[model samples]
Target: MRPADLAGVDVLILDRPPGGIAAFDLLETARAGGARLLCDVSDRDHDFEARIAALGLEAARDQANALHLAAVERRAVLALADAILLADPAPDAVLRALGKPLLPVTTPADLKAVLQGGERI
Candidate 1:
């Protein structure tokens, strides 16, 4: 989607990073529009390779490789995130590199608090 489409957006929660160069432009627009960017990094833990293999797909290897590449592209979005939503307090190197606040939320109340500008639980 174009940056202009993000007008009036208060927050942009990305489960996965947007593909290609447009990701940065959209993010910049959102930020400029006073929107908070929150990356839900817990989704990164899903093992696409294992899942594809379990499904017995012959092209599992190729599919897994493609998925990995897509995940790698997420760095752009992560770098611009105002905060990260994780399943646990454990911080990975990538997340730490972003230097953004990590909010480990396990319950709906915790998520609500975080979204409302509350401290990490």
Candidate 2:
């Protein structure tokens, strides 16, 4: 979706790998438009790379490029995020490196609470 489409959005949840540059652009636009950014980093791109290698897939090269782009996009998104949702007991190094507020989310209710402006856990 275009940045204009996020005009009145109160919150934008980035839960998956970015499609490409456009996704990062959209996130920037949404942030500029005053939308709260909540990034859910439940999966790590490096893990996907490892999985592809383990599978002995010929598409590894292309997938690696995409994952690399995703890593870049994720860093940008994290930089703009108001809070981060982490499911893992030990937060990823990226998350810790960025120093953004980390919120542990175990269930859908936790996510809903955060979106609804509930107190940080």
Question: Number of the top candidate by lDDT?
Answer: 1
Provide the global lDDT of candidate 2 against the true structure.
0.74
TM per prediction: 0.72, 0.74
Residue pairs clashing in model 1 are none
Model 2: residues with Cα > 4 Å off, grouped in runs:
17-19, 46-66
Q: Give per-residue CA lDDT, model 1, range 30-120, as digits (tens).
A: 9999999888876553344444656467666657777665656676667788888887689766678778898887899988898787864
Tens digits of lDDT, candidate 2, 51-111: 4665466776657767666667667767778888888858866678888888888899988
Tell me, what's the RMSD of every candidate? 3.8, 3.2
Error of 1 at 79 (Å): 0.5
Residue 64, model 1, lDDT: 74
Name the TM-score of candidate 2: 0.74
Give Cα distance to truth, residue 100, candidate 1, Å.
Answer: 1.2
Model 1 spans with C-alpha error above 4 angstroms: 45-68
